[model samples]
Target: MKPGSLLARHVAPVPTSRRWLVPMAWFILLLMLSAGMGQLEWLFRLVEPDVREVIYRRAGFFALLGQHVMVVGVASLLAVLLGVGGAIAVTRPAGRDFLPLVSQLASIGQTFPPVAVLALAVPALGFGTLPIVVALLLYGLLPIVRNTLAGIDGIDPDVHEAARGMGMTAGEVLRQVELPLAAPVIIAGIRTSVTVNIATAALGATVGASNLGDPIIAGIVNGNTAYIVQGALLIGLLAITVDSVFERLQPASQA
Candidate 1:
């Protein structure tokens, strides 16, 4: 056999585990294309000035995007903290009775419509980003809390018994054994919350927080499909990109 054929025969088929690379590459390409579209005005003047203005100048799509990200990021962080703590609280023997109640409450928050949340929050919190943040945080809480509870509860009982038998304190077992094992599942919950909030944060523009939704709302007022598509595409791309980054950050052993 030729040297190439011999090498191919001897080397076990190269593992196919790197499949994520293909999607990651495609995602990067799409992001670059979106960025170019976002800045199309500088490249071509043939497009009508008014259309260019609508795409770039009037709406401040990039600025609005940044605001939306900040709002979602802050809200997601807050939701994770609250959800994790709440999960821990309700899991203890003394707090066990309240677990279902807390879970139901969080579920209620998630079920509430973002638009309705915005409307109610705006009246009390007034304009700007506070109302938006509150709405997003509330809406994002359930998944994190539910996943946290599931992760902690799903641990093998034998492991817990072994930890206790080894004279480990409750806090030590939780900090060292339980949390490390549960980290992957908990992170999965956080990933879900972050992605969901990214889309929901667009509702902020309805209450004057100024996000990518600005163009979509304006487009509806003027019956402009292009404007709506541009805004929706940007928000959708942002969610996918951020979720991809988070997935990459997850423990490789778990993946």
Candidate 2:
């Protein structure tokens, strides 16, 4: 078959065992990271001997992980909506004039450092997860917006013309033709946005949002290497697992 049928291959059913493996592995890893960090309690006691063995007693590791996912999840959802929505709007004839402005705003949002955002936001929103969510949402927007715009714009004009020639309305063409062709690209953007935020969400620890970074921060404050290692390990694992899922979902064309 020609390369045109590649997308069909992309949607081919994954092995039943393989489909379950990723989620099961993800959950097992997640459980280990979130709750398993406590298993190091004995190790901490052995090393410290005198100091507070469990400096990370503020919350269980699993609790912090849940908070971490929550913050990143909310932020990524908002970014996807705003990013994809803005991209679609600007691509349309009615909003074409604002394309430059939309692109520029997303650019600025990404370039703006999370720390600076935290500093500025804390005064208005006060501490907690809200500011971090806002920061991550803004930071994560560029990829989705840029990818959406690129995906939609890269569509062959002939395909759109063919759709229109078939007596399809603009809305119908977009719904049935434009979006399917653009989906892979748009999803690529979403993958990037979500993956990046998973790491970035750790910044919430600095602002008292309390995620995986808690251990790292506490470790740093107390000069305890064990805590830092625990936090960093779990966060890294989470990133890798999530990125792997995205990798699987990525279209063959993206390859």
State which candidate has the highest lDDT.
2
Candidate 2, 53-141: lDDT as tens digits = 65477788888878888998899999999999999999999999999999999999999999899999999999899999999999999
TM-scores of the models, in the order given? 0.81, 0.88
Per-residue accuracy of model 1 over 38-57 as CA lDDT, tens digit each? 56645333433345344534
Best by TM-score: 2
Q: What are the lDDT scores of the predictions, listed in order?
A: 0.77, 0.82
- Give the range where candidate 2 is weakest over 10 consecutive residues by summed lDDT: 1-10
> Where is model 2 more than 4 Å wrong at Cα?
1-12, 42-55, 252-255
Give the TM-score comparing model 1 with the true structure, all chains together: 0.81
